[model samples]
Target: MRPFYCLTFICLSFAAAAQGVDPAITERPPSAAQLPGVDAPPGPAPRPTPPAARPSPAPSAESSSPLPDKDPASRVERLDALFADLKRASTSATADRTVDKIQAEWAASGSATADLMLIWAGEAVTDKRNGAAFDFLDQAILMKPDFAEAWNRRATLNYIASDYGKSLADIERTLQLEPRHFGALMGLGAILEATDRKAQALEAYVRVLEIYPTLKGAQDAVGRLSEELAGQRI
Candidate 1:
């Protein structure tokens, strides 16, 4: 009976071995549903990113430049103001100072308006400010090449400055443009006088007097030349 029992145990052991513990099963990789949360701990609220810095604007070419303050219009207005003040200046020194101020302002102001510049040039000549007068008148001529008044003013200034050759050239231009320009005629007379062409100066003065009998300086010039001609027995 014991042998039979042993045989039965052996049979059972054999059956278990035959079933050969199925090879150990391996686990499959986890699917998306079983994996760790993609939206897990909403990490400490993300810090707000600062905005990028913007580049500074480049400077403008015009704004960066240091230019003279006076333009043509401004120069005209300033010169007119200076002339107005000159009328009130008490002494020669004060007048000279005003003239200097105007010239300096003009220099700083660049080109001036043609008409105003001509007026300023005439004022300079009246004050015997030859250098300033010539500068202003020359500028006027340059600005308006065919401007008869400008040419005439320049001629008068040149004559006063003893620049007779330039004066003659300018006067010729003036006469070419306006034959009846009395100022130019007077300039021609003055130039002749300086060159000792007394006869020619007298003729020129007489012509001017004929045109405008009440001309301020021509009467004196005529009287002086008449006496000079008599003295020379011509």
Candidate 2:
């Protein structure tokens, strides 16, 4: 089986009332794994939006340039070091830099073509070109089934256009490749919360916090869920 590595970089976003688009199809999306069809809470589903760019397309082979390989041994060592720095960071500002460094490490797929396709797919998603994005991502995954980022990305698109089952499948594949993927875990948590699996959702968020304690979003989710769950048990 192909081994992949995924980071839990996604979360459920309850789009603020002010965040709506004009009555037209446009924009990006997010994650979760409490598969669909559960008694999920009544709310907008999580969507798949492109993550922050790692420099920036399905791109032509001729146009692609060689990228440095993320040699597993070296990259893992670096990530371990970075995670340590991230947790020790005293401020969000300081931790943010470490967070970016870790994600940059995670984004490298060794294959320039796959990277290009991922960039193209992100652009397509941003431009409301879901079909194009799908094509780009599909080609990327075909080319690199071991690409954890690719699987995580497809999971986002699957949830947006298809169903939770398909998205979760991709997510699980990502985790299979990289169990430390906090981003995938965040996606799982969000989906669980949406699907009315509050206990499971809390567990997921706690897992994320274990990886990145400075993440305010996870802290917020944990706090919110704790109160809600406590009330239920009361």
Candidate 3:
């Protein structure tokens, strides 16, 4: 969710090898429902890490100052328009562009300092120092408490560490700030599935599909959960 400042953003690959983190910990199903026509390959899982000991900060614990000194009303208006367009996009290409633009805006903290913290957090993740990455991201959130990307990335780190409870907590924060975050919604679905909350997971995936119809992961999850639930009912 961290905006790609200088054209560099968090890989979001979920399972990049360089990070020694398995994407599966984030969502570990045999990916099938192909993206368009091609099957999306599974990324390697990273070595298992224990959950963090400390409790996650409450959703209300974010720094009091959640915005930059300069008002970002115009940017908010632009993003809202793009989101509206995304919802109505008739073509895949148009939807893709709209998604990209929306995500870019979501990543921007409008503060260089906060952005740098995000970059550092990413680097920590790459180095396989997830604990360190969490610290960096916590600071980022403190500096820009309203930055959804910071909460999103931190949630990702908790997911990677297999701390589902913490991950879910942070995810709640992310969604609170950005309800339209399909990525967080997908993540919520994965965590729900992993925790044996199948019905909730299905609902989460369904929501993601409603937002981004072409998202292959959500498609696959929805199919899998639907089949599982149907078999149970039968």
- Give Cα-based local distance difference scores for all models: 0.47, 0.57, 0.59
lDDT of 2 by residue, 1-234 (tens): 001111222311111101211000011012332221011112432234666878445667864754424356777788789888976988777866775566556556767777666666655555566677677778878988897777776766666663667777887887787666666666666667767889887877777677667666677778888999999999
Q: Write the per-residue lDDT of candidate 3 for residues 6-87, one digit (tens) a residue.
A: 0012234222212322111121110101110001112332323556899755566454544443457777788779877866
* Rank ordering of all candidates by lDDT, starting from the highest: 3, 2, 1
TM-score of 2: 0.70
Query: Candidate 1 — what's its lDDT?
Result: 0.47
| Candidate that scores best on TM-score | 2
Residue 53 error, candidate 2, Å: 30
Clashes of each: 0, 16, 4
* Ten residues in sequence with the least summed lDDT for candidate 1: 28-37
Local accuracy of candidate 1 as per-residue lDDT tens digits, 99-161: 345433422213336544554544454355656656765766787776665565555445545
Which of the two, 1 or 2, has more lDDT? 2
Model 1 scores a TM of: 0.46
Sort by TM-score, best first. Answer: 2, 3, 1
